[model samples]
Target: MSYDRVRAVDEDVADALTGERERQNDTLAMIASENHVSEAVLEAQGSELTNKYAEGYPGERYYGGCEYADDVEELAIERAKELWGAEHVNVQPHSGSSANMGVYFSVLEPGDKILSLDLTHGGHLSHGHSVNFAGKLYDVTHYEVDPETGRLDYEALARQAEEVEPDMIVSGFSAYPRTVDWEAIQEAADAVGAYHMADIAHITGLVAAGEHPSPVGVADFVTGSTHKTIRAGRGGIIMCDEEHADAVDTAVFPGAQGGPLMHNVAGKAVGFGEALDPEFKEYAAQVVTNAEVLGETLEEHGFSLVSGGTDTHLVLADLRESHPDVTGGEAEEALEEVGIVLNGNTVPGETRSAFNPSGIRAGTPALTTRGFEEAEMREVGDLIARVIDNLGDEEVYAEVAADVQELCDDHPLYE
Candidate 1:
């Protein structure tokens, strides 16, 4: 983790690198999609495999000197298969979005219809936001969570599926706090004769540890980011039945991306190995427990959680109900000022702009990775409430900043 080598060659880059390391050590990273990979995973990601260009799958490469690349990729693929229990797994797509793209390419032609959750209601851009390529290439419709319950209505979704009759139905979410019923979604897709693609990008680790219901067997295709809840390095994965294995692999390679980042695949392999250990189940369980504690604490302070609470590692709070004057963007800035970093998120039935939305999303994957438990998470929730309650109070910021520093010291990272 030292920047000595970089400093010898490039002082500017080295300074930034060192500063980023220091910042991570100092702040509480509460971003829903972020987590700290172990040093082993980090080292694997920073390995010399970065120079490799093994453009194809194992035992079927397009170039020479791919012996090591093949080994790394095979190990990653095998580990991912074991982790998610898929008949076939592709550890290639450069990102989760790309993984979605690969799946889309494998089956649907351009202009084929897609049905997914609304982005403001917890969907990802790749699900078909107007600005994304998926939106441009596909005719996309949406299903919304029940406004009253703030949860999916399976019957309503089924009705919508029949009405839209989309070529595909995407399950999984970005900011949702509840566990998904993949079978329900699958049944909807079946009635409509549509493919069910469950994007478990945010809940990969939870699913792997059996803390959440997995979509591997229920959905036609499953995609996820390796880094989010899993603590794998930055990468995406695709899983499908053996029947679609060829199509998925080809789509991932020549269809969506070329020359996989083998270093990242190595990181995935290392992290997956770590996840297979018995302790990872405990870590995954703690992540959910901490999130519940955090959500409960926030609720105690008068904040209204989007779905009322969490069954996963993240919770989304709608500021409109409690602090009507404070926008999510404003709360995000004030929280960051005190070294607590999360994101301004858009809630269901959003009444504000996406940039400065009505909600804030907080998560516990990074905190749990840093050894934080329920008590520490509760304290964090209190600090967040204090900051949000007194946004412009400089004295309060100083007090919270001191407390954050103390918490950081108590649970040191990369030490």
Candidate 2:
């Protein structure tokens, strides 16, 4: 609950909302997949449009009085198409996972094969972890980066594609720090006649701003979250060539999700508008720059980083090397004590369980949105390293909390 932002809610509602906002304002948010959306996005998301339920696609509808909802949703769809240079766009998957699932539905049958990156090595669950629907319904073939260098082995990936002849080859990751070679993946997929999907949720903003390579033209299907880098509402979108438009749209509408959230669609419009601005390009560039500096700072402070360093906004730290006794979860909790928030993650070949893995994933998107720059990120990196180093020491975290407060004070959000 963010008290400072919501005035219309009752006392209790305001109290809850304001509390969350206050925490967000105070904390250093380094979670790789998180970001603070603009105020306009928030306003659109919580607008009166939520009161209506307009099931079906933009122009075609199942219910009466969907005129305005149709306009809003259509605007969102057009904006998405313009933003990503996609021939077709479906902005109603509810989440990136859902969007991935819809893409699967569009391209493959239930028992078809899929080749995706290994989950523990950086791929998302939707790519085909055992517990996910992708793994449950499909014959999933896993690929891994070179264990020695912690980087993608395109040659090995091509070899696997040739052997498996998978129905689809997913090229993306949730925790990877290096830039993906979309063209390489396209070649790999083409060699085996496999469909290609790029889950660019984390890098959508970077791609839009030309800070990262765009998968829009290269991938057969591109899926992403509106919130992470795009700084939009909390939802997912699917982009593809004109060839797959009908199948993808059907998969999202009657095939998977019910009616779209008109309110969130409105929010998506606001975010897309913001992303189209020139300043968003500058912001996206700074996001990657801040992350690289922070990653270096963490390495200099004795933390072992995944893939040596980050070329993107995320940095995955292997805490096992620097603090063998402290698990990722422990380090996460310790950092929270000092108002620094980040998620524990699994590193490649991690011996520990996923719930308490050996790595912590951090990023600069949220802090950059909060107006922190490269210098602040370096200081944040140092503070994060200190917190992880002294996990069980209460006095140490307390002292670090003071330092965190000072930093936050210097770069206060929403003042």
Candidate 3:
């Protein structure tokens, strides 16, 4: 992992890279959108493929020296097809948001209506946030989770869809911690003569392992990020039926982006191959089990979890009831001081602003990737509660940091 060659050319950038690697190894990564990739996948991402420009799909590139690129991409597409069972797949979008953009360009017209979850309620910026291009280009409407239950009320959403009559209904989320009923959402879209684009960016790995229900056959189009729960390198993927194949391909290449990140496609190929192993399914199942343990442990410490608990790999703890004076940002800072890294996020029916919301969101993907299980997560949850409960106490911070360091040593990442 030494960046010796980089150090010879530029010392500052090399130091930062070394520091980041050390940091990951030493701390807990609880961010739900993050995961640790295998060294095989990392090598592929940093491969010579990045230097080559494969401007088109496999076997149909605009440039020469694409033989290897074609091989990597074809392998990636084939493995992805086997993983998700999509009729057509595109592995070229640079990110999950770009994957959504590819679908929008392929099927949606400017000013066409888009119905999606509210951003503060667990949706993404690409799903028509006002600051994002999707919002400016389309007419956007949003649905929220039930304030009392802290879960999606599909019946209310269906009514909202009928009233709006959007051209496309976008399902999937970034923060909500429950199983999405893709069929139910699809039925609403069908009732309004609209298409469904399920962006399963957060749950790609779960769906691949059959731990979570897939949206591939249910939604008209499905999108995901390769890096999140999936051990793939950073990139995006789109899956659709054969009917929309050509349109998606054209939209991805000449429409939203220019050249394919061939390096990432190679990484995806490698990671997808690893995920096909039987052990990956066990890993996925443990991820959910670990989250359950984490949420239960937090609840025992008097923290209130949104939806009462979770069905996914993450849990959202609303601090409004348990620690009224401690904002999510304060808890986040205190946790980080003790080497536990997670994000403060908006809760449903938030009373605070987004910048410093009323809740903390933590996940088990990176920990599970590091081989952590129920016991370790329960310990980690206790440490988090201690740090939040004693925010300004130096003694408590030091004790928690020591406990966190011992756990990190036991799990040992990137070794």
Candidate 4:
């Protein structure tokens, strides 16, 4: 990961590249949306396929010299179909946000009603936030989790849907720690005569590996990011029934983007092929187990978890109940100073601003990817609690940083 070849030409760019690689190798990556892809995936993404400008789909092209590109894209689409059990798959969207836009372009009109989860309540910016394109183009309504329980109240969602009939309903979340009821959300969308789109961006790998319930057959549209839990290249994918295939393909290509990222599609093909192996399922299972251990340990340290705990690979802890004096930003900084990396997130019924909120979201996907187990997670949790308990104590931070360094040394990354 030195980027020696890059250094031969542009030393400045190579320095930054090496710096990033070293940063990943040294620190813990607890961000729920982040994960380390395989070296094979990395090679596939940095291939000669990047030179090709494939403007169209397989068996049909807008330019000449697309034979190899067709082979790569076709394999990607077929493997994605197998992994997700979708009748059709589109692997050309540039990112998860792009995939969402494709579905909206296919079925929704300007001023159409969109019902999605609230951003501060474990939702993504692409799910109709005011700053995003979806919010500006569509009439948006939001649903929130139960403030007391910190879990989704599907009955409340159903009542809201009935009151404000929408064109589409978006499920899936960014920082949520529990399993979703795709069938239940489908029922609400069905009762309201709206399409259901589940953005499994964070759990793509888990669902593909059978660690989580799949929304492929239940929801009208399923979108995911290939790079998250899927451990692939950075890109987006859309899955739907054959009835909506053409609409999705057209919307993705001529509608939202021009040329597809063929190299990333190749990487997706390779990564999805690896996921079909039995080992990937075991890895996915360990991710959830490690998260459970992490949440349990944090709870033992007097931290309050959203939804009580996690059934997935992430944990959301509301600092307001546990560390009333320390904000999420302060906790994040203290942890980062000790080489423990995660993010400050807004909790359900949040009273703080989005920039620096009252909650911290952590995950086990990357840690499990680095071969960490439940015991290692418990040790890590103890270190996190120590830092939180002594936020301004320099001696505690120094000791924790040394311990974190030892952990990083034991479980080396990208070696």
Candidate 5:
């Protein structure tokens, strides 16, 4: 983790890197999609495999000197399969979006209809939001969570599927706090003869650890980010049955991406190997418990939780009710000033702009990774409530920052 070599060559970049590490060491990273990887994963990602140009799969590379690259990729693929019980796993996609793109290219033609959860209701941009390439290429429609329950209504979704008759139906979410019923979505997809793609970008580790129901067998395709709930470095993965393995591989290789980031693949390998350990299950379970504790504490402070509470590592608080005058952006700013970091997220039935939405999404994955348990999470929640309750109080901000530093000190990372 030292920057000595970089400092000898480029002092400015080294300083920036050192500063970032310090900042992480100092703050509580509560971002729903972020986690601190182990030093093993970090070292693998920073390894010399970055220079490789293996253009094809293991044992079938187009270039020479790819033995190491092939070994790394194969290990990553095998570990991922073991972690997710996937019939076929592709660790080559550069990002979660890239994995989704590979799946899209493998089957659907341009303008094919896609049915997914609405973006404001916890869907990702790659699920066919107009701003993304998927949106531009595909004909996209959306389903919404029940406004009253703040959860998906399977019957309604089925009705919608029957009405739209989309070529594909995407399950899973970004800010949702409840466990998904993969079978229900699959039944809908089956009725309509549509492909079901479950995007577990936010809960890969939970699914792998059996803390959440997996979509591997029920859904036609599964895609996820390696760096989220999983303590892997930055990467994406795609899983499908053996029937679509060739199509998926071909799409990922020459159709969607050229050369894979082999260093990241190595990181994925190490992270996946770590996840296979029995202790990782305990870690994943703690992540959910911490999230539940955080959500319960926030609720006791009058914050409105989307879906009422969490079954995974994150909680989506709709600030529109409890703090009507305060926007998510304002709360985000104040929280960051106190060294607690998360995101301003859009909630269902959003009435505000996307940038400054009506909700704040807090997660415990990173904090749990830092060795925080229920008690620490509860105190963190109280600190967040204090900040949002007194946004402009400088004295209060200083007090909360001091407490955050104490927590960071107690649960040291990268030591």
Candidate 6:
């Protein structure tokens, strides 16, 4: 029997899956941290490797019948290393956060001083957000982007590093939409004799395709999520200098997690292979183009953009001055009514709570991957602006929803 036919035997399960798929087909995913993987990646993820219990590295396995597993794991590591120009790559960490934890655990003592970017300024929670393991376990110093320029305050970071003399300095973010200067960050890290770690989770594909700066050779450690811009399956990878390979490997396995997920690793291998294609480079370039168009269009529409605009695939819009009456939460709901999906984010010095912030973070990666271009992005921006302008009007929302469906149908994703 076919898998779908067998699944159809359970009526409620089939209904649930069908309904969820319909939800995906209807909504536009503008979340920067999300993307739709190729069906090839999905197929590899559901392959027979799902039943494996490979606990050790390639060529030295803990289980029998490990030849193919060895080959797949080795290929993932080699491809990842070459893609990023890293001396060593450990593709075992389960998530970006997990990869982050591995780095901290591998290098620092429990209370060692660590410096990282602040969360409100586009840093991740795992980068010492006070609630995560990094903040709780390490002595953390945070730096923010300049309020006036809405960019990294590298001078302030340098001062903090010199003052604190931290053991490590982490440079990466979850909402930053500008380019990162590894040289400046490396200087700060060097000033303090710190190990520099750059998490390119949001821009791994961009870096792989030369759309963004590479931190592989510059930083002591680099980490990323495969599923985001990399278009890989859901997992994380950590790359480092060859000298730290064993430490990183131990950190990922015994220090942070147990057995690796072989199925996901297989999917990652497939993703890495796809990322090597020349077309992926074009895709990466288009991501930036679409973001530029959307940002320029929104600014022209009188919306206030954080950093004045974007240099990357994301655009963070300030809703306070643009649409003061509508909070980020309300705007999110309004856009959702129009089949546009995005996340509310905290603006710099935001007065509102996190649940209903003063900003919205949207991106073009998924749309660009679906073959949308600058023209479509302009239309998308217009639709988004209109939705924000008419957030409280149910009639406008219903009408916009129809238009969104038409637009999506005209340029169907994953077709």
Q: Which has the better TM-score: candidate 1, or candidate 2?
A: 1
lDDT of 1 by residue, 146-175 (tens): 998899999999999999999999999999
Q: Can you write out model 2's per-residue Cα lDDT over 1-415, one digit (the tens) per residue? A: 2454456547777877778878888888889899998778888998899998888887689998989998888888888887888899998888999999899999799999999998889999999989999999999999998998999999999999999999999988899999999999999999999999999988988888888899898989999998888898898999999999999999988888898888988999889988888899899999999999999999999999999999899999898878999999988888988999998999999899899999999988999998888788888988888777776788988888998888878777766
TM-score of each: 0.99, 0.96, 0.99, 0.99, 0.99, 0.97
Ranking by lDDT: 1, 5, 3, 4, 2, 6
The local distance difference test score of each candidate is 0.95, 0.89, 0.95, 0.94, 0.95, 0.88
lDDT of 2: 0.89
1-415 per-residue lDDT for model 3 (tens digits) = 9999999999999999999999999999999999999999999999999899989888898999999999999999999999999999999999999999999999999999999999889899999999999999999999999999999999999999999999999999999899999999999999999999999999999999998999999999999999888999889999999999999999998999999999999999999999999999999999999999999999999999999998888999999999999999999998998899999999998899889999999989999999999889889999999999898999999999999999999988887
lDDT tens digits by residue: candidate 5, 201-286: 99999999999999998899999999999998998999999999999999999999998999999999999999999999999999
Residue lDDT tens for model 6, 19-54 = 766776778889988888888998999889999888
Candidate 1 regions with alpha-carbon error over 4 angstroms:
none
Clashing pairs in 3: none
- For model 3, give the 10-residue run with minimal summed lDDT: 406-415
Question: Which residue pairs in model 6 clash with each other?
Answer: none
**Clashing pairs for predicted structure model 4, backbone only:** none
lDDT for model 1, please: 0.95
